[model samples]
Structure formats: structure tokens, C-alpha cells
Target: MPEHPWDQAGPRFRPPPGVTLYVPVVVAFLVQVPPTIGVGLWLRAEPRWLLLATALAAASALALLAARAFPGLTVAVVAAIVTADLFLPPEVGPPPIALAFAIVGAIVRGALIWALGSVGAAWLVVVVVGGVNGHPWHPLRIAAATLALALCFAIGAGIRRRVERAASHRAQLVERRRANDQAERARIARELHDVLAHSLSQIAVQSGVGLHLFDREPERAREALASIRRLSATGLDEVRGVLAILRGDDADSTTPTGISLTPQAQLAEIPALVAERTGHGLTVTLDDGLRGRMPRSGIQTAAYRIVQEALTNVVRHSEAAHAVVHLSCEDDVLVIAVDDDGVGSAGRPEGGGVRGMRERAALLGGTVDLTVGPLGGTRVLARLPWEEPA
Candidate 1:
């Protein structure tokens, strides 16, 4: 159940909303210039560099700062200026042209709503001014202005869709990365389990055999004792590799067994595994031609476990005279099957070890089969995926 370390990494920030929000609103409002006059003709307004220059810069800066919270309000105010142009001669003040983009952008992809608000604000101010100014309004003229506002709204809606789509894509990427990390963590867990479980199981069997020889035949016992020592050393190396994979950074040369460690174990370890198990009074034959062909650590561990677990069951329950383990790569799968002529029910599973054996296979995107062999021996078979990246 150990999880990926990257799962702790959190979400990243999205682009700050409303790209053009600050520019037009603040400068136009502060200097009290129409969008055309305050921004466009600021140099012309300065002419003689009157104290009015100081006043203009200060006013524009404040308006820009305050516009952050009131983008809608600033847009409303500018709309009012446009309406005033209908009754009075167009002033030489700044023209409020670009507020269109700012207001629309703030809507965050709800361009239609932004459009409605912009239109409503503009229409109310202009229509009311026409009434107050004692001027008879022309529908055609108003229609022209309303049409322009509608176009702006449409533009805003398009921008919103783009923003939302990009945001959704980013979110999907985050989720995919999270999922991939979880899968990798599970794979590592299975590899560690297969190594520890298989090796420990082998060591236990070797120790048992050595003890039996010590009591029955001293010479045979000595041979079994040597196998036991090798199993212990190998187990320590695997445990260390597991620790290094788990710790990632701090893991070093020695493992829990007080022996030096290797970076990883390959199929080469299989023969040694089989040889050690055979020394424990069982007959184990490993095919060496298949060694270099099997490359992935995950697959190696899975194949090792199937054989290891199968043998352990035989030693504990079979009371059988002999056992045989076979491991090879077939159709891109690291295939393993262990058979024993033990006296107990060969196919029956009465302990968690069998379940653990199956779990190990499942984690590798593989499968396990346990049943009685035709020879009346219990057979354990596992197939695991092999990594083949160059």
C-alpha cells in the first residue's frame, strides 16, 4: 500500500484571470480623459507641461489600482461617458474603446452574461441621457450602437470558451500524472514483496533441511548447512535492494541481513535460488539458457515467487519425496510452474501464502493458476510482464 512520493505534490496555479483588466480603466478614469483623449492624446493634453501633468499621472494611477475590484463598475462609468457624447459635442477627452475587452475578459468564459451587463449599462445611461437632454431619440442610431455592443459580447464568449478548454486540459493532465504515479508505486510494492516473500520462504526451507541433516547424517547436514548460509546471504541482498527502492535516497550498500548488497537481481538469481532449495533435500532443476533472455526485475521476482511459494507448500505439507520447479520466458511472459509429489492435497490452498502468490502476479498485470497436476502433484503457475524499454 505504499504510495508514490509525487502524490504529495499539489496543484499548480492557473493564469491570473482578466488579462487586460487594469490598463484602460485606471488610466482613463484617473486623468478624467476620454479613452481617446486621456490615453491616446496624453502628450497633446500636456502641451505646455502645466501642473495638470502631475494631476493627470496621479489620477490615472489611482484609477488603474482601484479598477481591480470594480471592472464592472468601471465599465459602467465609461458607458455613461459614451452616452453623454450623444447630447454634447464629442469632447477631446480620452475615448473609452478598449474597456470592451476588459469587461468581457473578467466574465471568465461567460461572455454572454458579460455582454448583457455591458449592453444594459450602456443602454440605460444613453437612453436616460437622451430623455433628460430634451432630445428626440432616433432608433436607427441606438440600434447601431447596440449592434456594436453585441459584437463585443460575442468576442468575449469565444475567449471564455478557449480559457475553459485550456483549463480542462490542464486538469486532465494533472489527474493522469497522479494515476500513473500510483500504478508505479504498486508495481514497486509487488516487486519488494515477491523478493522478500520468496527469499524468506526459501531460507526457511533451507534451515529446516539443514536441521534435519544435522540430526540424521552429519555429512549431508554439512552440505545443507552451506546451502542455508548462501540462502541467508542472498536474502539479505534482496532485502537491501528493496530498502533502496523504497528509501530512494538514503539507502546504501548493506541490507537488513548484515550482508553487502547489489543494485538489483536479475534472472541469474534464479539458478542460485533453485540450487539452494535443492540442497534442502528437494530436487530443483533450473534452465540456464533462459537466464539472459529474462531482463525485468519485476518479472524475475514474480517467477521466483511462484517457484518459491510452490516449493514452500511442498516442504510444509507434501511430505513428498521430490519437487521440480520450471521457469522460462514464453510469449513475452515470465512463466513459472512448481510441482511437488507431496502427500497432502496439492491443489488446495489453506493459507495466506497462496493468496500472496496470486497477488504478486496480479500486480504485474499478470495471472496465477493453482491446481492439481496430472501427476497428482500440486502445481503453481504465474505469468508476469517483462519490461523491454531500450
Candidate 2:
């Protein structure tokens, strides 16, 4: 709905709905005037014939105006004038110039049946009157008239089709844009939930431990305070990284910019994640199969986030003391599974964290299956395609 410059240029440039900005009616009127004057002068006809010729020109001009409201009426008027001109003389030169414009208008405005019927009636009138007045019916003139009418209809139909196609293409583009916006929003939500949930849970646990032991054990309290400080700084830096990405800045650069920085989390970071949870009284073990290099960044990030969320859920909701994280490649697919000796029953419903893990895996062409683990606890298993589809 952007405004066009022509709309602001002047008031007289207004056009009706569905019509182009510039109307061709005035040009049609002007084109009709010269032909009428030319026809009368070329024949040197009597005053009565000149008057009739002038009236035909006036009717042609009126057809231009009438076409804007009733294109079928314009077609009928033009056809009648053409039939009357045929009775005057052989060299009277068909109908007025407005006949072409009127025929085109009728076809473009959904009046094709009316326009063709009018033309057929006019052709019959020409034949009957010519036979009665001793003028032989000319087949070549009739053929030419039919061809001209056909050409007018074809051109009008072509323009209408082109406009329809352009409008359809625009609608498709708008729908695509809306879909992309929704996908980007979902991606951001997943990123924020994964980053904040785990880090805040760790901070909360460490703070509670520090407060409990502040007077009973000073040294242990100092260590807990140190962990809290480190966790806070790490959480702040990760949040800053997300914010920089939102601002369209590159936060993935390994080169330090006044900050102790590491790369974005990937499959390589699962061991560190497990070690961190182990210090918090969760006995965790890790097993790796795909060792040397990883696949695409997206697949690696999704794998890492899935493990992170599963462990976070165990730390926050489960009463488990031991956990196992396994990563391996099977059938050209990266597989990640985490099992915890935590409560696994229908009483504990799945939360958004589980849904977020599923969404992340699905985005990377993967699936997550939740069930009871071998150790009589909850199990979170996921499989991701190693090679991304084209």
C-alpha cells in the first residue's frame, strides 16, 4: 500500500477502481474527431450525409464515456453506427474509430457474450440492407471486420490475464515473508530457553549451598561463593553473546574482545557439561563414538543443546544421583541418549524443557523418544541426521 507519485501530482488524475491510473477515453474521443472530418471531406458528400457523419462521430465519443459504466451498451451503440455507415457508400470506411476501443472494453469487462451478439446482429443488418439497396454483399470486408473484432478481444484478454498473474505472485511473496518471520521467532525462543534455563538453575543451586554453609564451614562456603561468581560471569557472557547475535553482530569470533570468550556450545562441550553436573552431586559418565570431526554446525549445536536440557531437567526435577550420557554414530546418523536414575512415572508430566528439546531435534531433522531408562529412571534419547539435506 505504498503511495505512488502520480497520485500526489494532481487532482484531475483520479481514475475509477480496477482501472489504470490514466484513462484512454479522452484519447479515443480525439482519435474519433479527425476520422469523421476526413470521411466527409474525402467523399464531398451532401449536407445531409455530412450531418449524419457528424452524428456518428458524436455517438463514438459517447461510447467512450458509456464504456466506463456499461461496456455492453457501448458495444451495441458502436455496432449500430457501423451498420448504418455500411448503407451509405462502399468507401465510407467501416465504423467510427471508437468501435475498436468499445470492443476491447466489452471483452475485458466480462461482456464478451453481449459484444459478440451485437457484432453478429450488425453483420446480418449489413447483408440484408446491401441486398435490398442493389449493393452486393462483400465477403472480404466482412472477414476483415471479424478479424479486427477478434484481435481486440485477444489483446484485452491478454492484459487481464497478466494483471491476474501479477496479483497472485504478490500474494505468494507476502505469505512466504510471514512464514519466515514465524520461524525466526521460534528459533530465537529456543536459543533463549536453552541458554538461560541451565545457567540459572546452576546459579540457584550454588547460591543455596553457599548460604547454608556460610557459618558452619567457612572454607566450603568460600568455594561455593567462588562457583557462584564463576557461574554468574559465564551466564552474563553467554547472554551477551545472544544479545550481540540479535543485534546482527558476530559473537562467534574466537578472538577476544575485552572478554574471556569460548566458542558456541557444540558436541565437544558435552564432557565439560557432564563434569560440571558431577561436582553438584550428580554422578555422570560419558561415552563417545564419533571422535575426530563433527558434522554441520547446526546439527552439533542441536545435539549439544539436547544433552544440556536433559541434564538440566534431571538437576531441577529428578531425584537421581547417577546419570549416563552416550554419543555415537550409527547408520550415518549422530545419536545422543541421556539416562538418569530419577523418578519416571506418569505423576511427573513433561514440561516445556522436554518440548524445547524435541523442537530443536526436529529442526535438525531428528527425533526424541522419552521412556523409562534401563536403570528404572527417565531416559531421553535423540537421533540427528549427520549430513544435512540440501
Model 1 CA deviation exceeding 4 Å by range? 1-24, 30-93, 97-102, 109-114, 117-121, 124-151, 204-229, 239-272, 278-335, 339-366, 369-379, 383-390
User: How far off is residue 376 in model 2, in Å?
Assistant: 4.7
TM-score of each: 0.55, 0.74
lDDT of 1 by residue, 11-63 (tens): 55555545455555554454344343444355454443323433443343343
lDDT of each: 0.60, 0.77
Q: What root-mean-square deviation over C-alphas does model 2 reach? A: 6.1
In model 2, how large is the Cα lDDT of residue 78? Answer: 86
- In candidate 1, clashing pairs total 17
